[model samples]
Target: MSKTLVLMRHGKSSWKDNLPDDERLLKKRAYKDIEHVASAFKHCLDKDFVFKSSYAERAESTAKHFLKQLGIPETHLHIESDLYTFDESSLKAFLYTVDDSLDNLMLFGHNPAFTNLANALGDQYFDNLPTSGLVMMHFKNSSWKDLASGKTILHLFPKNLR
Candidate 1:
């Protein structure tokens, strides 16, 4: 079975200390970027995608916006706190727990880690996953456990769409 993975970085967050890290919401521009990327994904919604997002407000808000715009049911969405700042190994462990029934999966998380994880599973080198950037990758196998670098088919970012 073929598998598609959509990896997105969280939108820009308010840096004010008044709000906790987890409570920081997306900035206005970030929301705009999210909408742009979500609109792009709408063309591919027929792929039957499942979404997994970090529990942080920015990430969750980004995921919610995508769900709302893409008309994806909330039941197919998961909020995982573990994905907040995890490394490739941690992301691999999380992917291991995903149900095999899901064919196309989207992950909304933070940068550096998300960028690294995407690079680790696909032969793409992104200096940084900019705010609200989205990357789509295709793997030959059905299972996430078997994913590795050099298997990517496509990659895109919000700025690219601009």
Candidate 2:
């Protein structure tokens, strides 16, 4: 069976407040973008994927908004504190640890991790993965441990979606 991985960058976050980076919430435009992207992207997915989000407030909020817009249950979302990093190697290591039984894994977090990971593990090159951007890579390998390069099947950005 083929394995699929979807990497999503969190929506634009509010910087008006002096709050810590991890505590920052999504801006109004972010919510709009997330909704639009999620609604359009949801149609391309299969029902049995595992969804995970970084523990950061902005990322978690983005994940929740996406789930709401996609009509996916909140029960399907997992908050991973380790995913908050901006390093692609950390993200790749995390992917390697995912259960082999799960064929599809979706991650919501920050970048240049997402952008770098897409370039390292995908056939298509990405200059940047903007806020609310998503990239899906399909691999022939059944195990996440053996996941390396794969075909970039879907790449969606909020600006392009609109």
TM-score, every prediction: 0.90, 0.97
For candidate 1, the lDDT comes to 0.81
* Tens-digit per-residue lDDT, 1-162, candidate 2: 889999999999988889999999999899889988888786776548899999999999999889888778899999998899999999999988999999988999999999999999999999999999999999999899898889999988999867
Best-fitting candidate, scored by lDDT: 2
Look at candidate 1 and give me any clashing residue pairs: 123-150
The Cα error of candidate 1 at residue 101, in Å, is 2.1
Worst 10 residues of 2 by lDDT: 39-48
For candidate 1, the 10 contiguous residues with the lowest summed lDDT are 148-157
Error of 1 at 142 (Å): 2.6
User: What local lDDT score does residue 57 receive in model 2, on the 0 to 100 scale?
Assistant: 96
Superposed model 2: Cα runs more than 4 Å off? none
lDDT of 1 by residue, 90-113 (tens): 887887777777889999998777
